[model samples]
Target: RNNQRHSNNDARRPPKTFMPTNGASRTSRKELLDLIGNNPGGHLDESSRFKFETKLRAYANTPNVDPSDVLFAIGSSVYGTNISFPVQEQTNGSKPSDEEEKETNIIIDFDYMKAFMKDVFLSYGVKPVHAETCSEVLIEADRRGIDSHGFGRLKPIYCDRMDQGILWPDKPIDVIKQTDTTALVDGNLGLGLYIGPHCMQMAIDKAKKHGVGFVVVQNSTHYGIAGYYATMATDAGCIGLSGTNARPSIAPTFGVEPMLGTNPLCFGIPSDDDFPFVIDCATSVNQRGKIERYAREGKDTPRGAVIDSDGIERTDTEGILKDMVMGKCALTPLGGAGDAMAGYKGENISLIRIELFIAISLGRGLNCVRTKCISVHHFKSDDEMRSKKKKSSWDIVK
Candidate 1:
């Protein structure tokens, strides 16, 4: 029976997930759990099996996940679940208590993490310089506090895609057309990490010469984070702006199926501060990456962030991700689910750019298949500063 099979191979599962950062490779997990919980072992029961498998799959999917991240990610699932590991080791021994152990974070050095990721890319036959460039972009997400798009994406977004033949890490970038201030490029299914920088640098170079530049890329896959490209322009002392289109996940205001990607937009303005003033966000209220992070944490997606096939708000992160990719569910737009808060505005903002890019690119020469958008918003002159302790200067006009 299925029940008997579930009981057979799952007994060692819990203990086998010992945190690697604890230097515990020499100390097997079974021994630790035995010491802590009287060597308890049994197959996962049907009810708890669902929870256990969910957490286990997430753990297996993200192998290189940092121990610090896993502390919160699988910590609660491990300690509180009824499947196994019933007791926590005490502070009586030289070993630290569960509380202290949870706080013990083995942080990865930034350079080391970058070097490791570069090696991962290189292993896939990426050119050394291109691999390094991709690594830098992925690491910058962590540096900028965008955990959703950081190294967590490596296996699923890059390595797995490469494995499945969805991404070509070694393809050359082709410039389809070029003008003094504009360009159309084809990534040839290349790594977005390489294509993104190459395109942004071209834009930056043109900006230096002409005060503005426009570059559109097609056939690229996920490009790490949008902020990385926008910041590149800031580093060059020019206002940097960029966006990327991704696989569709967002639905229209009243529609049920997905018709738009998360459609992130990011820009960086040089400022007097230590870092440039940068704004980066997906047009959807909850982007797919954030949902993936939640799934990794064994947590539910935020309510109203996603909608299922029945037109109901869905909170199951894993299910929503699966359904969205399959067109059975869709993400709510930036404002929320309905027109009550103008969610359609967000839906339009994310979708129209893709059409515009494709049309423009195809009209010129090659087809535009990339997923990002960029546009300017202008504001009229307004009142000057007012005291923070009092009403604003604009209040007088009102």
Candidate 2:
């Protein structure tokens, strides 16, 4: 039964996503508008779905198009499993076999995407300015083709979280400590999608004054795209750095049961061109979410992405997910296997990450609750340590 359900979905394929850019020529814009205007019957019923309805409505209102035309344009953008374009013909003295369309084209106005996101959040009762900032972070990810972190998250963030009371639109992100080069931000348990950027910008401001800045945050929810914050730092003429530790998905090498989060690391380097050089990656060989994505598509995963319940590598995406998340399996570290095969190096890096999470955990006041926390019980004040050194010198002379 499960296999049949999976096969049925695989026959349908995923929907085609649309994203527009800023520099499209007028002719291209007109052609796109006309294409959409000419085809309006294929959209998923907007009135029945929460997130998609909001998005379709927004896409419909983009500048210089009729409401009727918007519906047609959206309809034309629909894609399914059977949608394919021929590349060449067969050659029995005839042409070679045709090639399939290799990619999908999506045109989204960056500005319009932002405005629509902002409107959706506000209509849903999020505060005005917070809505705008959240929109900026989410849409920027779409512009970059990072769909997992883009509009795809709107439901969990705004809709589902609203249902769960996890999203606090009115709660403020408070800065508890500040110096020339550092600050501590408390999220008040607010959405990280909103607070992450706030804390990062504070870091950027401090960096401007001291040539480097750092901020530690606690009680924050998921920050949409790590690159958004990192790029903000780079835009200020400094290299931007961002990382966040989440619910654990990684297990220590040789040890079982998950204890480490995917703990993504992101860096944005300034470039001479229009776009910054951005690299955002999860520390594990693969993100747990990516495995879920493969499972949804009825595809097999590549080797080395995961281990099964019995500690054997497997290609079945769903099996990998069930094993990893349920504590029956754990992901491989950034490097494969043990110290002899760079396992020790991966372990060392995880240790460094532990220190980082420790620092964040400490600032958040959650470290004390850790069952097996790293001990930091012995410490000497600077003056006491200096006096001890002097006394030791006298003993040596004696």
Candidate whose TM-score is highest: 1
Predicted candidate 2 versus true structure: per-residue lDDT over 1-398, tens digit per residue: 00111234444665343334333333444554553345332122344233334444454445433222333332322311111223334455555432322222223455765775576566556788898888888877777766667655565455556556765666787777767876656676666667776677777777777777767665566776677777877787778877765565665676545666566667788889988887877767777656655754568987765665466767877777666646887776677544445654554455455434433334222111111110010000001111212223223323
Worst 10 residues of 1 by lDDT: 377-386
What overall lDDT, based on C-alpha atoms, would model 2 receive against the true structure? 0.55
Residue 68 error for model 2, in Å?
A: 18
**Candidate 2 residue runs with Cα over 4 Å from true position:** 1-116, 271-277, 322-325, 337-341, 354-398
Off by over 4 Å in 1: 1-102, 361-368, 373-398
Estimate, for each residue in 1-398, the C-alpha lDDT of model 1 and write its tens digit. Answer: 00011233443343223354443332333333343244111112344435444454444335343333333332232222222222344566465666576444344445766776787677678999999999899888876667788777776688768877888889998887888888777787788888888888888888888888887766677787877878888888888777765555788898778877676778789999898988988889987778887876679998988887789999888888888777898889978888988998898777665434433434321112454432211000001121223323243223
Worst 10 residues of 2 by lDDT: 374-383
Q: Which pairs, if any, clash in model 1? A: 244-371, 244-372, 245-371, 245-372
For candidate 1, the lDDT comes to 0.64
The TM-scores, one per candidate, come to 0.70, 0.63
